[model samples]
Target: MMKIYLALALWMIIAEHELMSGAELICKRRINAEYRASVLMSPGYPFAYPNNMRCEWVIQAPEGQQVEIIFLEILTESCCDTIELRDGNTSSAGLLARYRGNVSESIYVSTFGSLYIKFTTDDSFVFNGFMAQFRTATTKTQNCTVKLDASDEPQLLTSPGWPYGYENNLLCTWTITAPEGRVVSITFVEFETESCCDYVLVRHGKSMRSSMYELGGLLKRPFTDVSTGPIIQVIFRSDSSLSTSGFKIQYKAVKRTKTDLMEIPKKDKCTGKIEIPEAGHGTLTTPGYPEKHENNMNCVWVLVAPPGMRVSLWFTSINTEACCDFIKIRDGETPTSKKLGILSGHSTKFAHYKSSGNVMRVDFQSDVTKVYSGFRAVYEVLNDSSEEKCGGDLRAAINRRQYISSPNWPNNARSLYCAWNITADEGYSVLFKIIGFHTFRRRDSIQFFDGESAIPFASLRRNTQHDDESFYSQSSNMYVIFRPDVTTVQGGFRGYFVAVPKRQRNTTPSILVSNLLGQHGRDNR
Candidate 1:
């Protein structure tokens, strides 16, 4: 079969550090495929060793379908000669990825870092899922990251008590390995389930019926099983510290017949737009109402304020899920004019699970104010992680905190370093990039928008593909940053980074650059 490559970048806007330390936004993107192949991060050009990268691919054939997974020789087999696929200390296998530097031995991280596999049509395979997290390049090295516990024999079985939403565990005649002398202390750390207030168990070299432990353990830690029942597992870790080191697990009934696990049928795919109101009825004026996406994205009702009145746009998604998707709202010119609100992946990054309207108030003076209009927020949705990210409902906790900065610049950077204008306890945030941005190179002062005017803090990302089709070549690389609080700041506050993506080379000829004006005011505010 011919190979078609698919590259997806989960672009998110990050606010300044108002949150935690050592926390970097881990952007994760997943795709379900039937087979596995070599998937690693390449740093564009050459680098010392490889671009210290990690990739995960689902390989085992799902139950019901006998299938075979295939990998493109062009990408994987070529480098197979020099690359390592599994952990170093352990007997190697070309089927899995190798664990090199930065991989902690205490956790399955070394094995989880990067993985590759090949499937055959004769072997059953089903869906393929991918994960992309805006995680720190640094690995987690702690004695308590992954916990495991077991007697001797281990077995693979399903138990509703498995932590991290899983209902299965491996109890069997499994083997355990650790980093050097850490093995004895690295038994089964602990297993806690998101479902209940208790812990579950899995025995080694046994079956589901035998892998049992009581709920509620005094100490919880990371763990791993070597081999249990039919499923052979060398490494297993939870989303949030399930198991780290080498834990065995036998294969489950998730296997399928090679023939049944065919390509995803197009008929079952997601179709046209979902009929939902952009803004749930949180609060609205007689003139200003929620934006709905029914008619060709037709946004009705312009700047209609009864004499002297201030409009409060309360979003219902403020506490619900409508906020996970994307929508648009505009005023003054056409609905297509400068977008008043264009939510980015930041919405999902925010620890706020409240679905609908997080408020955006605007005071229009006699309807003559430039942005004399309101907006309907378009949302960004979720795949793997849920609304309870970094921390949930951050806005509702703190309100009205703003901070600015003075930062480092002289480098070949696109954005300036501005100190974050944030308050310790306030529902506030640092603005990264505003939508409706007008990049002017001709003049020093750039207009934030081309038309009448737009609102502030209204989320936006450059449509480089459509904006400066010539200058902004890498629309994929360019993204915005948004920090709700210093606590939400994952790693150390590295300050806001402005990136201008470079395009691939010109094979023949592309679009021409138009003379554009310059905008002097940067977000270094």
Candidate 2:
């Protein structure tokens, strides 16, 4: 006859140490308090183990549902990881749980009655709080946008290509610094009048991957990074047109050293500009190499409209709404930018004489030398404004001392798409562009696999949460949720990648990261 053990404990782990370091409560919750405790685990009392290592405990359950325990005294540690249930099993040998001990790890036990669960660890620095709470079973939560004219964290800083103007597929540059181990991802959401198109996402300077609608593209591979976050270059594009008034990349994490954040690269600085030939259309700043702004709404630049120079300012605007959006153009150093004219049309494209667009003919009218410029617009954003969609913002970042590694320069601009339909804790199919990679260093047993070179989310392995086959259908570049704010790149994600490359562009800007700005940030220069 075989003997079975049941583990029951109000408290599983009890570590009463005098010289305890690298120990943490992490987070804990009573079951039913919040359904999010674990997308995979059921709502119940948060189960935790207390010993320094070798978790040992038991739980008493009602006679009928003993098989609900997914894990028992699950022990987690940093550095290396492994999985060992009460049945003396491992991630290998086709077990359900494996531990690489690299990123993170946990142990689980399954049974309905009283079960004995124990776990141990080698790293003395880690001690996670495995919570076991009691709550009713619920569905998973889907991430949604929070429409805002006001936000907890305001824009603080921005570039010229916002509000009413975007270059279809354009490249832009930004700089930032961050501490080690932090995550940084950009956000571009908007409430358009349903007339605008969907936008694309990119990581300029690093990888150029458009939206992922399907799974089998060469651009869906997973990339790694070693640099501190507040990563420099991140790109975004408009899938459809939209009249964006606000944008932001909510704060996340940064993992690097302090030294690296302090001594970052110094690219083009926002300065006064000089007049140059065919600089740009529609009143662009010259003299100042990198555009500079003192306040959130103020910037300085030099514009030229010489006598008989045959030059006209060009721009696109929102025409669906009854009222008009204003772009002010001014000359001189009055502490502001000027709007040469208004793009009062409904369409987003503009041309000179031979087309159906708005253009300000430079029949040699405006002054030449007194070439200073400023731009501004104040108007209500209509509910269904058939203008632009999607908005983005500048979040936080950190830097490190040691430089991150990488593969080749300008990783091939891979384009892809995805289509997913998921419910609750079940989510899968990750479409990403690779920038760098490293070796595994933990004991893990989660069912996962890799795709072809560029098409990462294409293929996968069979394992626990991932084995359900539903994940493969619910993943796409535009809809990635978990770790939504984190990205890895060669030489660290902080190294930077250009958002918009010159080859494929119209208005969707690019991201260029050369060096560190001031104190790990550029305030959108």
Candidate 3:
């Protein structure tokens, strides 16, 4: 029986060599000799494979048997050329392994009746391809857990079926070790999985109690984390149902220096109450300001100014998931405080706000689906004075118009800095008409913004006459800023605003009422 088996293997090798010498550019074959080991090779075994070549091979075992494959050599372009192994007969089956670059000898066992192998090359570089041997085994073995030692060069780690979704009911773990006096760092390049039923748990040490992160859901951007020590363990788990494209990670060993051992500065908690310094200025940032924030976070921050002073906040940057996350600002310290604005999505420009009283509250909430880099803001305490008293929150009525003007408008107003927020009812937009416009030709300006964004949509400056010129808001709010040089005194601008349906005609005439009685009559009707 041994002699016959050896002869059959020799015959298979001769046949494969003859086939390789043929003119076919693409090669495919199947092997079902359950009792004899068979060799699999790329289109050109010891030589460089041709560019744009694709080859496939299927090895099948009899009932109650499993297929095992051992790699003898693999050399290909780092990322552009590749080899893939699946557990079943088709490409859609659960992935067993993927290889690129020069890999050491490795072994893989199929969980099903057959194993599928595919080799593909791009149009660019080519290299000496892979060679493996496969045979059938009577016992089944799971090849899920893997241990790796980190080196100066980075290494790639991926889920069982990365790029393609992983299989269900999987419990895979990877333990990475770095040399003494060094630490391990892992960066997630792509991440997506079942939000509720799949998770990747990372631990700084070998034990579960040392877990540093339990990550799931979808990450919109790449982020890196360093382990506390020289060892880290990552575990991936999935339930019996739905799956998604799993995660891809790159890891390397980095030396720990003196700076790493020094005491690090403390960061503010995710939820806290802060008091502004006597200097009346400070800054605040989301938990992971420069990096992607975590999923499913609800953080709140309250800022208290000195007695009799109000808080003015400026957001330098803001980026969050557009649909399921928000940063809400309020006028007071409590959740029930009057809302100022709800900001979300990537901010194209900076945003600024001021509270009516001494306290302001900020609330940030994120859902479990996706995450992005959050916001950064600064605050200052401002006392009520001539320069700070011109701007206030204004609500527009459907029938009556509200008017706003620069400080001491129609007069020589000087040293003024003012801002106004105009809001209309839901489903309505603010209509602003400049009834009077006059300012120093080159020393004063009035700017208009569409919503909470700081990017101005329009501006009046340089003695430009804007009387009877009108603008409309894209949403229920509009922001305006009026500023004049402290050295120049000039006649400022005036504007009237009213709430109108979004679909209303821009040519619609403004409704002007003279007295409170007429306004009340219109409101009552």
Candidate 4:
């Protein structure tokens, strides 16, 4: 029998000083506590491991269940240092995997009752280690592909065996067709997959060879699409290597009425110009505030807060014809000011927008057809406090530092959708450091961007409970956004932002090193 080396966290806690510095932990202390769900990391995660270390672990699941393992990150000596997975409790069992180099993927296998993992490293250099998660699942699984036709009813589609890494070398497809004179809509609730390599391909018609229309990408963002005709097909493919959380989509068919098909004349009731008072806040609605808006209309709203105070807009509801009839928000009074973001589709959990100055403009345009319940938004004047309210925009002083927190933070907080635009003088950059963080897993996120863009340079979401290290900006402007789900609120996040002179950023690290050396000298004396 192969020797089982168990290096657990709780054991290290009990004997921290006695444990060797290069030793790695293979499993957790309690079998029952970690049996259901747990994440496993290579010996020293987020850090490189020492040379000449060998580790082995045997994972045993409940009878009649299989074990699934997912590698979050894997980097090591490509040929020498390797990690292997076997299907039995011993080395003599069938080898399920032997991996090295830059390999990151997920695996699912049945070892009858236990799965054996072995890691070997020679006396040589090292790199950042691996991290993985292991869980249990039933032997019976869903098919790789599914088909649906002649159905107008709503249905749900998920990646084969979701909430787990999908199987390797798999292709799954879903087809939906409306009864007659109806339209099909596919709304992806959440989608995360390996871009290009493993993806979900969408077609406007019935088959893989459909030429009417085709739309497919890695679907990293939440998306919803309405087919141009009655038939729609979706294909999901996964290679033999890496996999992701996959996706869950909702599909339905809507019957087309006469009003939905024909172009309605523009109504003048809510299609005229509107302006809010200079004192500060008010609400605005589309042509029909609570009802489906009219087509072929144009509306504009100008918000003027006090001269020094900026304006903030929050969209409480947003449902347009997505891309076709859309709302545009700008930071200034003119049509050429910084365009904040084009609003379309369903409202996101976080829908807060802010102006860089006291003046902001909003323009809404609808095509001749296809309209949904229009948007309802409200604007407020931002105060002068360094600590602004949650869900509004905030700016940091060029030479000073400030703190930001979620609404009711360090305690149960409200569903928060907030943004902070930290800016500095022309030769400066911004530095952000997380003080603390806690939120509902998988449904909330705090993202950081280099400029006024939607794509984030880095983000902190749930499941990563560590105090985030500080982030230094390459530019003078930085944007931070916080979005939390509606239910199951938790103690939210707090962080500090400071502006640093770009010229001094390089020397700042040396200054810290000298300070550390001085402290060590004093200790030695």
Output the number of the TM-score-best candidate.
3
lDDT of 3 by residue, 1-525 (tens): 999999999999997767655515446777783657878778776888877767787888888676767789999875457788876788766555567778777655554568888888876678989888888753312566789999899999998888989987676778899999889989999999887657786777774235344678899999787888999887676756698999999999998766555342233348888888545346677787779987767788999888887886766568887655788898998876877877877864435578998899999877555788897776766433234348889998897876676765555566678888999999998888865565544457777787888776666654433455577777899888887877656556666789988854444323221222232344331
Residues 223-288 of candidate 1 have per-residue lDDT tens digits of 432332333222222334343222213222222234432233232121222222322112222123
lDDT pick, better of 3 and 4: 3
Clashes of 4: 0
TM-score of each: 0.19, 0.17, 0.34, 0.28
Candidate 2 residue spans exceeding 4 A from truth: 1-52, 70-75, 79-83, 86-114, 133-525
Model 1 TM-score? Answer: 0.19
Q: Which ten residues in a row have the lowest lDDT in candidate 2?
A: 490-499
Q: Which residue runs of candidate 4 sit more than 4 Å off their true CA positions?
A: 1-280, 384-525
- C-alpha lDDT values of all predictions: 0.24, 0.25, 0.73, 0.65
Tens digits of lDDT, candidate 2, 1-525:
122222222123222231122233221211212223333221111432333344333443333322123332333432222333331122111122233222222222222133333344443334443433221222111222111122224232232344455433222223333334453433333312112222222221221121111011122233222223334342222222243432333332334455433232222333344342432222332223123211112223333333334322322122321121212333332322222333322333321111112112111111111222222111110111122111122111122111111222112111111122111221322322212112111111111122222332222211111111122212111222111111222111101111111222232212211111211354342
Q: Poorest 10 consecutive residues of model 1 by lDDT?
A: 403-412
Candidate with more favorable, higher TM-score: 1 or 4: 4
* Clashes (N, CA, C under 3 Å) per candidate: 162, 161, 0, 0
Between prediction 2 and prediction 4, the one with superior TM-score is: 4
Q: List the residue pairs that clash in candidate 3.
A: none
